[model samples]
Target chain A: MDAIRIDNLTKYYGTARKGIRGIEQVSLTVAQGEFCGFIGPNGAGKSTTIRTLLGLIRPTEGSAQVLGLDIGKDREEILARTGYLPSEAMFYPGMRVRDVLKLSADLRKKDCRREAATLCERLQLDVSRKVEELSFGNRKKAAIICALQHEPELLILDEPTSGLDPLMQRAFFEILRERNKAGVTIFLSSHVLSEVQRNCTRAAVIREGRIVACDSVEALSRTSAKRVVIHGRVDLGLLSGVRDLEETQESCSFLYSGGMKELLAVLAEGEVHDLSVSEPDLEEIFLHFYSRKQ
Target chain B: MTLIKHELRQGRISLVVWTGAIAVLLVICLLVFPEMKGEMKAISHLFGAMGSFAAAFGMDRLNFGTLTGFYAIECGNVIGLGGAFFASLIGISALAKEERDGTAEFLLTHPVSRAHVVTEKLAAVMLQVIVMNLIVLVVSLLSICAIGETVPWKELLLMHSACFLLQIELAAVCFGMSAFLRRGGFGIALGLTTVLYFLNLIANMSEKVKFFKYITPFGYCEGVDVIMNGGLDIRSIATGMLFAVLGIVAAYKMYCGKDIR
Candidate 1:
């Protein structure tokens, strides 16, 4: 069974204008034990989709299910099995980190003391400090502990690494990898493409409230266009699979997708001052998709 | 249950401060009652000349000579205003605090449903108001005894009960209003309570606006009316209860469907 299934889910923030889309007909599915990444720029409906899945905001239309339970009708049951970390970590002020974790366990009706202690130790979190006294990274670590202590079947994280240092982020991803190995499904939303590329097997790129691309990481990388830059004026306008072509007095650049041998032969015909060919990064690929749509 | 415990712990300081303030005011008023007892006639005539002021505050109907009458006129105002403000403050912050503190996403994503959250928060606020009223009750009883005044049990119970009901009604109204606010609602709560009190005052001062008494919770808890009639007005109490129920129902409806942005 799929861990999460959303069909034509849409949300319109009615207060803004007549048709300001929070998300428009967003549909996707994550199979059991799958690690899925949701990538988007700010205000691109990534958080909206996560919030809708958690039943924090009702959908304007369409339907969703989490862990095979209806997102609307079985929200309590779904929430019981799903753990979430919001983009901004907030806790009750004047409470110790331990107290916050304890409160979360109490609300979930679970005895998570052992797991919470283990998580705190692993994350190097100080459980004795008050929530308001903790720095942003520490607070995020505390939030991570709260979300993971209950051993939920599914973990939904939104921008979970925003406040963490590079070392802490590495540790956090390692922990998530271990959890995923233990048969826990993961849905992570982030704007950083490299982060998603490092951790997620499948990714969905959303742009302006729509999914621009959704595919496995390997397939996406294989199909992505390559960046080619040439100097010394080599292009004679005879190259196939060369689109988005640009020319200058001393250099030419374009995205190439055809055979590499033919391209090298074309480049060898000219006096090449410099040449570079590399796989496009996710940002470039994302921009390609966005520009093509326009 | 966890939510309730969290709310109680969070509200402990506010509960202590409001209860202590009201208790101190009640004690001071009870202590001053004795000095004025012998000068009742002159004081009544003095107040009588200021007809509008006397009637607006219910001093015209209550005699300052008798202990119950003095308690009705003095201690009543203290608890009435103090209790209403306390209840309003508590109720207004009950739901809005989640948003103001940026904790709505944390709480709403838990295993509990939105309806459960509303119920638990309302229960906590109501519990706080009850505890505050109970403390005031004990303080009033002890202060009256310290003054060597015989307790008029029935009238005392009636006045306290009326105050209790008034506070609950005010809390319900403010609780409903809090669902619509995204930030702390101190101003709105205080404004609503003050406006209702003044509406009750206008109802008392002018015969033309007498119908305003039915609309304000303050009208149902009139200490002079409770003292003179020896009990609460059943019809007014029923109206107050109806408003309270409607307000709570509306709050639940709005909160359950509200988008936690």
Candidate 2:
């Protein structure tokens, strides 16, 4: 069974007739144990979609199921089996880090003390400090511990590494990779395109509240335009089917979607010292998608 | 249960401050009652002649010469107003604070359902109200004893029971109001509490608006009514209770369907 199945899900901020659209006709499914990345810019409906699936906000139309349980009706059951890490980490004031972790575990009705201790140690979190006393990164570590300690079947993380330093982010992803290896299905919504590109097997790009593209990482890279850079005097103006062309004295680069043979035929006519053609990174690809939509 | 405990812990410091402040004020009033006992009759007549001012506070009906009478008017308003504010503040902040502090997303995504969250939070508010009243009751009893005055057990107990009920009614109403508020309800709670209080005073002063007594919790639990009648106004108490039940039911209805943004 698919771990998450969202069909024609739409959410509006007000009444459906007179409300701002949050997400429109969003339908996607993630196979069990697949690591799917949800990439979108700010206010692009990434958080809205995640919040709707988690039952924080009701959808204006359509339906969804998590772990085969209805998002609207079986919310408690779905939440029990899923762990969500929200973008912002806010805890009750005057509570110690360990207390917040304990409260989360208790709500789940599980004995997660051992797992919590291990996660805290691995993340280098100090459980003795009060929540209000901790820095932003430390609070995020506490939030990560809370989300991971239950050993859930599915993990949905929204911008999971915003405030963490690079080292801690590495540790956080290491933990996630281990969990994914242990048969956990992960849905990660992130702004850090490279992290998603490096970690996720499949990716879904959202633009203006719609899923503009969804495919395997390799397939997406293969299907989209490739970045071409030449290090010699070349007439980029002669290149057809190319956009975003940048020219310097020694180098010229542009994204090319034309056939490789035609590009080579054109390159042989120029005085070229070096030439490189590469699959564009996710960021560039996403920019392509955004610009194309606009 | 976990939610209730966490909520209680969050409100603990404010609870202590409110309860301690009211208890200290009550103790000070009760301590001076002994020295003022000799001049009570003259003072009672003096207040009786203040026309609407005396009647507004029910000072004209209850004799100020006796300990029960003195305690009723002096300490009654202190605890009445203070307790109402405390209850209103607690109830108003119960649900809204989670959203205001940006904790609702973290909370609602957990295994517990929204209905469960509302129930536990309402339970926490009720529990805090009861605890605060109990502490102040104990302090009042000990202070009366230390002053070597007769406890006037019947009137004192009835008056306190009425005030407790009054606090609960106000709490339920404010709790219902909290579901609709997003942030900074301090002014709203204070305004609601103050309006109801003045409405009771207006009802007491004017024969034309005497029916307004039925609308405010302060009217049914008036100190003079409890002291002179030796019991609560059953009809008015029933009205207040109906309001409380309506408030609680409305709270559950509105909160269960609310989008916790």
Query: In candidate 1 chain A, where is summed lDDT lowest over 10 consecutive residues?
Result: A285-294
> Which docking class does model 2 fall in?
high
What TM-score does model 2 achieve against the real structure? Answer: 0.96
lDDT of 1 by residue, A152-205 (tens): 999999999999999999999999999999999999999888898889999888
Q: Write the per-residue lDDT of candidate 1 for residues B129-237, one digit (tens) a residue.
A: 9999999999999999999999889999999999999999989988988888889999999999999999989998999999988888889788898877877888988
In candidate 2, how many Å is residue B113 off?
1.3
The estimated TM-scores of all candidates read 0.94, 0.96
> Where in model 2 is the C-alpha error above 4 Å?
A232-241, A258-275
Among residues 3 or more apart in sequence or in different chains, the pairs in candidate 2 whose N, CA or C atoms overlap within 3 Å are: none
* Model 2 lDDT per residue over B163-250, tens place: 9999999888888888887785888989999999999999999999999899999997789988788799999999998988888888
Off by over 4 Å in 1: A15-17, A234-271
